[model samples]
Target chain A: MVKSIHIEKLNYVYQSGTPFSRRALTDVSLDIKTGSYTAIIGHTGSGKSTLLQHLNGLLKPTSGSLTVAGNHITSETKNKELNELRHHVGFVFQFPEAQLFEETVLKDIAFAPKNFGKSDEEAEQVAAKMATLVGLPDSVLDSSPFELSGGQMRRVAIAGVLAMEPQILVLDEPTAGLDPKGRLEMMEMFEQLHQEQHLTIILVTHQMNDVANYADHVVVMENGGLIANSTPERVFSDPDWLHKHHLGLPQTTAFAAKLAKQGVPFETLPLTEKQLAEKLAELMPQSGGELHG
Target chain B: MVVPFVYAFNILNLYFFMFRIMVLLILKTKFERERTMDGIIDIKDLCFRYSQENEKLDLSHVDLHVNEGEWLAVIGHNGSGKSTLAKAIDGLIEPESGEIFVDGQKLTEESLWNIRKKIGMVFQNPDNQFVGADVEGDVAFGLENQGIEREEMHIRVKEALQVVNMQDFAKHEPVRLSGGQKQRVAIAGVLALRPKIVIFDESTSMLDPEGRMQIISLIKQMNREEGFTVISITHDIDEASLADRVVVVDDGKIMGDSLPEELFQKGNELIDLGLDVPYPQRLKFELNKRGIQTPSEYMDEGSMVNWLSRSILKN
Candidate 1:
């Protein structure tokens, strides 16, 4: 029951004291368990990104407090004092490929580690290991990152973050802009990391299917406030609330709901395609092609 | 006798020249007919390569025709050359071989600027498209580039903003707008140009779910109401499902071209092309595996719901 991250009454206002001042997050509170996969879902400007920025001390809370990976942060926290916290919290920004700038893929991946005081040789070694972990071939390690394809560039950016060997990995729409196959592969890589490497994952995504399939816990945000914090099943059980917030249900959950309205018996909603298939199979006849459309 | 033979050879040469001219005239008419076959954009065996070292052409002998007022969705995995085809159509990059015709005008160096005016492209990143200080300024940037008068630019910019429902944010800076609003502003920029065709190059890929829906609806409105032909290049199957025709590109070639409903039915082929099968189709596949027979034809969410309810009620 170790809490990897805990936020209490966190508030953030952008451009405070100016005419353009706006409150991004208002007294939000949440807890993320260590080694647990958590998905954050909300509309744009819902303070999801603002809250994520606070996890690694990218943005300090205007009021209240947060403790992430044993590092305490508040408005009083200085930029220079956040080095230790950042080491344990890795952030993969949206369109991360745009962030790659090194001449070679290996150099780009090794940049973060070398910046954190690792020797050149040590950083390169770690970078190579992380690159392979992210499915990047060694042949391209010496090549310019700009020469790689979009999907490969994304992997290099991810390997750069993984080179830090952080305990908590935060991803902001990591699969955005990728093809369906690439999206699936990227999601699977993160899942493998979460299960095998035991890394705590916090993902901000618009994809409900990713939430239902991968996340154990879900957090919902609306208008700069925390609305719901619970398991995926509890959060998605009521479709009305999600729709009201301009959110959507996972395909399987939505399909199950449609079936439920037609007098199909269900103890609980199926969250995944496999679960839906199993549930429908029990009610169906063993013979194939017997029922008329 | 030899003088008469030379005279006959000269006469034969004249006949051959006349026959060649006649054939050329016929081919010219046929080519023009194909270019104007109600296709606003026609690409014929287009081939392009990024560099000499590139082993395969970025766009390899690709032939695609987009009908007037049609919403065409081009989908492919990363580096599959779907974007290259779009760039070729826009004249952003010159192809190594083959021809492209937009609005029946061939795309060449001489016609590049004129053809560009007819096609407006919204790229993946809205931030990159911004060239002005505020929303209104951004929308008017294109018109300004064309030497439009200030008063006329103002009217058109306002109208474009009103169409995207971004009129209220006319004074808002790009930094202040949400992702969806930024995209709307980008669309307004395209709309002010009054282009015949609008290319959404993975425009919704950077947006959230609600933002994506808003942009998609706006594109649909433009295509249906305003009579603008749409060419959307995307990776989202759901978005592609909304198009009138879906073209699957794999490895610099068109793998499948059909209606979205018919295309989704080829489940394994879509997966092989690095695309996704729609949710309803995936559900059908899962059900069929467990000895429950589902229809072979593709079913969207609504039809799938109806079929599921009907079958379960029968049992």
Candidate 2:
């Protein structure tokens, strides 16, 4: 796996030295293993957003080094080339698609590549291809971006980012307000991209269920500091650790914990529905009676 | 001449008394219905559309009844008119034909302030709702507009902050607070007015699940203590599952309005409508497929597990 994102002792403070000075991030150091799907979980004001901003050079750290794609992002690089790095490290801001301003979805999708000096014909070609990749229908290309459904519009926004074809893709709260199915759909898309393209993914989400199913790495933050960084199973098993940070495991995980406390001899912690079924079946009597109300 | 004058005087006195009684009753109803009293909103056949987008209104013949001190969650896919209906109640937009009464007054600009007096709304985007750049200022903006006296304003602002556990942030800049904290400030602003109903219109939609939980739990606590009517407009059914009653809106009409279990029983339909059919519901649904006769309804995760354990043990 490639080490796509590397941060060393990163620090960021808002309004430093002023009466309102706030340390948004302090001594943050972490490496996002290249090609691994990661989920960053934290309550708001927990420096999750601040950390996200730092990943793409949108916000410079007050101190420490960041090595991304062999580029020293923390160093005062040339302005022209910073844009170049951003192209490779594509970031889709929360509800990014809602900010689309174009006469047609096709035009909106092509806007990014056009800014990068791709010819009109070449940009449209790339946009068309990216549009399909994000699951937007071909007919939507000529349709007004604003006229499409909210879900469709969101896909178009993601397609705009996909047009950039960055090695590392960072999405901030992609499923914040979506319904459960829409959220799952978005996760499926992310999983597919990571599995097929081997694109390094940095997902910032609050849903433990999502992290439980897809994330290879889980980063927990609280009050401007990293609290825990580990795999889902290890972190979720320690209910006390998660509870201390205002985090809760998936409902299923919590249920499994309850069973474990009842002196059930579970082989391992169950994080998914299937695991829960298998674990419970093993403990219960073979002649399972019909479950009643 | 004296007899004729006396008759006229008697008639005039009777008319004046009747007028005063009518005025007193109206004023009395206005104050009581707004202050800590219940059954605030009664809406029927409500269909609203923007004049600019007249052809676009999907909410037609909508019927909803919300009681005082009750929490009702309206959920659906995007563009389901949940937000639009909320705005209509707030008088942000008027329904074309439907009549909405806040404390028994028809929806009209003349009665808008009085209606708004009964309810305060918190929108989806915390940034859009802030009237001031700073935290205290943002919270105070609504109170100031309502012409609350300065001293009373100070007292209420502090009270609202104390309620949401955001008292220490009275002077902090809005940008300094996290999204959840910012929403807490937003809720405080609405709370300061002491409105009978505080409508949260997807207020936590922009937050992470952790922040979403914080916001919802805060509202739940407030509902238990303060007894305000909570009407939440959301797309997340899981969050909606915690409400008193779940109303599923599809297309432009409500397809189902019942307890969470009733809608969940319509399993595939709920899924087709783009709802996740909550965790406990999903578990029960799968169990039923496996020939398990679960109870009529399982209230929550803990209860579901408890019921399963008991049933298995009994059997």
Estimated TM-score for each candidate: 0.90, 0.86
Q: Please, what are the lDDT tens digits per residue for candidate 2 over residues B49-149?
A: 65655676667788888877788988777777777888888898867888888766788989998889889888888777777777778888998898889
Q: For residues B116-195, what per-residue lDDT tens digits would candidate 1 score against the true structure?
A: 99999999988788899989999999999999999999999999999999999999889878788899999999999999
Instruction: Name the 10 consecutive residues with the lowest summed lDDT in model 2 chain B.
Output: B306-315
**Which candidate number would show the highest TM-score if scored against the true structure?**
1
TM-score of chain B of 1: 0.86
User: Which tens-of-lDDT digit does each residue in A23-114 have in candidate 1?
Assistant: 99999989999999999998877889889989988799989999999999999999988999999999999889999999999999999999
What would you estimate as the lDDT of candidate 1?
0.90
Provide backbone clash counts, one per model: 0, 2
Tens-place lDDT digits, model 2, residues A37-117: 889988867899899887777787777878787778664655565676788887878787678999999889899999989
Deviation of model 1 at B145, angstroms: 1.1
Provide the lDDT at A242 for model 2.
Answer: 78
By lDDT, the best candidate is: 1
